[model samples]
Target: MSGIYIHIPFCKQACHYCDFHFSTNLKKKEEMVLALAKEIEMRKSEFQDEIVQTIYFGGGTPSILQIADLRFLIDEVYLNYKVVENPEITVEANPDDLTENRIIELSKNKVNRLSIGIQSFFEDDLKMMNRAHNVEEAKKCLEIATQYFDNISIDLIYGVPEMSNEKWLQDIETALSFDVPHISSYALTVEPKTALHSFIQKGIIPQPDDEVAQEHFHILVDKLSENGFIHYELSNFGKENYFSKNNSSYWLGKKYIGIGPSAHSYDGKNRGWNVSNNSLYIKSIQENKLPIEIEILTKTDRYNEYIMTGLRTIWGVSLERIEQEFGKTYLDYLNQQAAKFIEDHLLFVDDNILRTTKKGKFLSDGIASDLFLLNLE
Candidate 1:
């Protein structure tokens, strides 16, 4: 089964650490919605033979749209695609946008899941990140949302400058208090061109400490595990059957269609992404032309992706699958490159599946990169 992702590229305000494609000016909200519908129809044939199992609304801020606007987009998907009975429909929402009435409205629209962007529960942390919602809004929204939705996930940030271990633990505890089934936590990274990056460059803010971040990662893994949450992915924890189907489909290299500006699509062999600009995306779709760039994956490219994503999840890379799909040469190369990590106890092969040990989980990306076949053609 395939999945569909809709990227809403507008935000109420910019977060200091965010680098995602978005516009604070929302004059074209209605126009953008129509354009998204048009694009969805235009790309329906891309996945005509596949049943859509998941529909995700991710963005700048999907919750900023009015319920009617959201319904319009959801209806468009139904009109153009053959969806599964009771497909997993999710929308990423900010605490500020999810009022009591809004939560009820979303439930009626077949939105089975809510991925709330409650980055922090502390007022100081919220202000530090320039979050649009306050501490009260964060708690109130969850209290109200829980009454209406059971499949909810909340995001939390760790390793922010000056955020002590105590505060981080408090954040985790606060989230647990909600008793949500899934949690997606990430470390604060200073990406180039983001306000946080500039502030660090100018000494206005201290750079993120890798050692502290590593410490926080361990704390997160341990706390979540103790609470009976499976560390299903490097940055995700979920109870049984509560894992994100949309995201899991992507990680497992399943086919998906991504609609809207800056969205990406993959169909087993090729990957494509739309232009990041809003006006350009709308204009191009209006002209019946897709504003996307596509690339066909080579054997090495696909192998490297399998290595990276597989190492990050609970299901580790399969040595047998490697030999079956990529042949003995690629399998031998993977074995050769993985030997050092295995020797260091960072990675281990159990029952022919190469998985990262707890010690190597946080550094899985780096470890995966080292095993890549850079010069393979």
Candidate 2:
């Protein structure tokens, strides 16, 4: 019913498009891992149940850690918490780090899933994005990974300025050729303060075109569907029994404990996030204090959250849960707000489930926000 997320705050190199909390300096990695283990012991009773179904190693390339380091953390989880027998343990990885030996080592530690970061299968695209791995490395890793883990997911970035439609199609084809179980694709967004954003601003790199991104999006949907992959979420596609349980819990608003620096945790009612600074986080945990910020969820906060998270998935928002959690008035308000969208062929209500139509998926956030109750105060 509950899950855990551990953030690894180190990466071999920083990709220009990455805005994640990570550092290339690995001087504090050993200390940070030990600190994270201590934090887990401290926060063991945060969740009511001791049974954890999923343990996700996410963030600044979890694949960079040594096998023993990862095994030590898993041991700590077992010692401090009553982990479920068949827990889904996933590690987010980069292509270059996933050698055949490394994959075999990971498998021995009960790491059931591998989420590889293979943005593109072309050298030019990889160089343009400043990715550490090349196309050959990408293919080799996936080929080696399939031999070890059946539940493999690879990430792809679309809408890069240099990525032509033919190249994009080839990327999809290349992924399919790998026969990986899951694929998480995303548009290359230029977030503020990122090297990519600055490059675009300075005309050193062309800005991503919204039109091109949308074209790629449609292609993704069509191609993935044709390939027997379920378009389960806007950014995820998977075969039967291959959906990411760790990520699914997030969209379903399930409780999860996020450990390590810059990790976030939520328990349906309230949410908390660890500090992003590694040194500060380690220092605080060493002092037997959690470096975190907490927010208590209000009725309106819950309502709006339901809309935002639920509408993004194929499940959509449940009116029954809304009525039970937020009362009947909120449901009425949602229906009234959705009236315009329904007429515009963007949304529909069926069996008390408010879901987005095909035309609405692209603008799902905007539509969901329109139905949000902002008078939380």
Tell me, by TM-score, which candidate is best. 1
Q: For candidate 2, what's the RMSD?
A: 1.1
* Clashing pairs counted in every model: 0, 0
- For model 1, state the Cα shift of residue 360 in Å: 0.4
lDDT of 1 at 351: 98
Error of model 2, residue 115, in angstroms: 0.2
Worst 10 residues of 1 by lDDT: 368-377
Q: How big is the RMSD of model 1?
A: 0.7
- How well is each residue in 198-311 modelled by candidate 2, as lDDT tens digits? 889899999898788878888888999999999888899999999999999999988999999989999888999999999999999999999999999888998898899888
Candidate 2 residue 135 C-alpha distance from true site, Å: 0.6
State in Å the error of residue 105, model 1.
Answer: 0.9
The lDDT of each candidate is 0.95, 0.90
Q: Compose the digit string of candidate 1's lDDT tens values, residues 206-244.
A: 999998999999999999999999998999999999999
